[model samples]
Target: MNTPGTLYLIPTVLADDTAAQVLPPQVAERVAALSYFLVENARTARRFIKSVAPQQVIEELSLTVIDKDSTEAQIQAALHPVAAGQDAGVLSEAGCPGIADPGAELARRAHQLGLRVVPLVGPSSLLLALMASGMNGQSFAFHGYLPIERPRRVAALKQLEKQAISQHQTQLFIETPYRNQQLLDDLLATLQPGTRLCVAASLTAPTEYVRTDTIAGWRKQGAPQLHKQPAVFLIGA
Candidate 1:
C-alpha cells in the first residue's frame, strides 16, 4: 500500500500567471513541498530546486533523477511508491517537464495509477516566441531541435520552411543554448532572403529579448549576444 502521488508539471520558464507560463509559483511551490522529486537532470535539477527555495538542500531530500538514457524498469520501480500515496515532482533540465524533456512515460504510468496531475504556470519559450513571431500561429509545428550537422540540418530546414509556406503554417523549434548561434548561422546561410525569423531570448528574465526579422536584416544588425542560455526560434514565409 503506497500513498497516491500527484504529478506536478514544472516548467523552467519564469513568467507571469498565464496559461502559457504554468511552471512558476504554482508548480514551484508544490515541487518545494514534495518529499520526493523525479528530475530529468539531477545535477541541474538540484541547482534549480535550490534557486527556487534557497533554504532547501535538495541533495539531502529523497529525489530520483532520470534521463532519456535512464532505464525504464528503474524509473518504474521508483514510481511504485509515488503512485500509491506520495507526491512526486517531474522536472526538466529546462522548459516544461514533458516538452522535449524526458518523463512522458513516467507521466503515463502516474496517470494509469490514477494519480492527480497538477500543472504550474510560467514561461514557455515555445508559445511565447510563436505568439510574437507574427507567423501563421493558427497552423504551426514544433519540430524540436534541428540536427547539428550542416548539410542535413539545412536540408531539413528548407523542407520544413517550404511545407510551412505551402500550407500556411509556422515552423517552430529550439536548440541547445550553446549551439544556438551555430543554428542561426546555418539558417541565415541556407534559408531564402525573404524568409522571416523570430527569436525569443531569455523569456521572462530581466534581459529578455524578442526579435523578428528577415535573414538579411538580422545579418546587418549583427547577431544578438545570447551566450549559452535557453531560447526559442521560429521561421516562416
Candidate 2:
C-alpha cells in the first residue's frame, strides 16, 4: 500500500484585490506544488492560483467541484487521488476552507480515510471581523447565516442578543451580500437598544469598514450602505 498524500485546506483572500497583502508566500508555494484541487468554483480557484503563481499553467491543474450539493460518493471519488499518493488541495470561494464553506465535508472524509489534512494560513473574514469588533472574543459563537424569512430572522436576532447578554458571549453571523442591508435593518429593529452591534464589511480590502456601536447609536447614525457587500454582524453585551 502506498503512503496517502496530504489534503491541504488552502485559504483564499477575502477580497479580490488583496491576495498579495493577505495570503503568505507559503500558500503560493503549496498551491504550486499540487496538481489536483477540489474547489467550490473552478473559475475563481484558477484565478486565485494564477494570482499567486503567475508561472503556473492553469490547464495543467485538475480542478474538481466539491460544492454544497456534492454527494458522499462524489467526495470519495475526489479523494481517490490523495489516497493513491497524489497530494490534493481544497479551495474555498473566499476565506478559509471548511469554516462556513462546503470544504468541511471533504476534510471530514479525508480524516475518515486516514489521510493527513493540513490547513494553510490565510485570511478569514469571520476572524478578522471578530478581532476588530471589540467584543468578547474568549466566548464567541459563529452562526453561519440567519433565517431568511423576516419572522424567523427577527426571532433569531432576539435569541442571539439574549445569548450575548446572558453569557457575555459575542454572537456572530453573516447574510447573503444582497440581503446584508435587510439583515442589518432587522438586527436594529430586533435587538435591544443597549446591545452592541458590529458590522464589518469588505474586510481586508481598501474599502474595509468595521464599526461597533450600541443599537441606539447605530439608529442615530443611520443604516450603512451594506446592500451588496460581504459583511459580518456581531451582537455583544
Candidate 3:
C-alpha cells in the first residue's frame, strides 16, 4: 500500500507585484516541489506559482478549485491524490490559507484523515496589519467582514467597539474593496470621537497605507480615499 502524502498549506503573496518583497525563499522552494494543488482560483494560482518558480512547468501541475462555494465532496475529492501518496498543496487566493479562507475546511479534513499537514510561512495581511497597528496584539479577534446594510453595519461596529473596550482586545475585520470608502465613512460616523481605528490598505502593495488614529483625528485629517482596495480594519481602546 502506498503511504499517504503530506498536505502543504501554501501562502500566496498578498499582492501580485509584492512577491519579491514579501515572499520568503523557503516558501518558493516548497511550492516548487509540489505536484498538485487545491487553490481558490486556478488562474491566479498559476500566475503566483510561476512568479515564485519561474522554471516550473505550470501545465504539468494538477489543480483543483476550492472556494467558499465548494462542497464537502469536492474537498474530499481534491485531497484524494494526497491520500494516494501524491503530495499536494493548498494555495489561497491571497495571503495564508485557512485564515478567513475556505482552505480551513481542507486542512481540517486532512487532519481528520491523519494526513501530515505542513504550513509554510508567507505574508498574512491580518498579522502584518496587527503588527503595524500598535494595538493590543496579545489579545485580538478577527471578525471577517461586517454587515452591508447601514443600520446593521452600525450596530456591528458598536458591538465590536464595546467588545474591544470591555475586553481590552483588538477587534479586526475586513470589507469588500468597493465598499471601503463607505465603511470608512460609517466608522467615522458611528464610532466615538476618541475611539481608535486603524486602516491598513493595500497591504504589501505599492499603494500600501497603514495608519492608526482616533475617529476625531481621522475626521480632521480627512478620510483616506481607499475605494476598491483590499484593506484590514482594526478597532481598540
Which stretches in model 2 have alpha-carbon errors above 4 Å? none
> Following a full C-alpha superposition, what root-mean-square deviation does model 2 have from the true structure?
0.7
Report the backbone clash tally of model 3.
Answer: 0
Per-candidate clashes, comma-separated: 15, 0, 0
lDDT against the true structure, per candidate, is 0.76, 0.94, 0.93
- lDDT by residue (115-150, candidate 3, tens digit) is 999998888999999999999999999999899999
Error of 2 at 63 (Å): 1.0
* Model 3 RMSD vs true structure: 0.9
- Candidate 3 TM-score, C-alpha based: 0.98
lDDT of 2 by residue, 165-195 (tens): 9999999999999999999988888888999
What TM-scores do the predictions have?
A: 0.86, 0.99, 0.98
lDDT of 2 at 131: 97
- Looking at model 2, residue 87 earns an lDDT score of 95
Itemize residue pairs with steric clashes in candidate 2. none
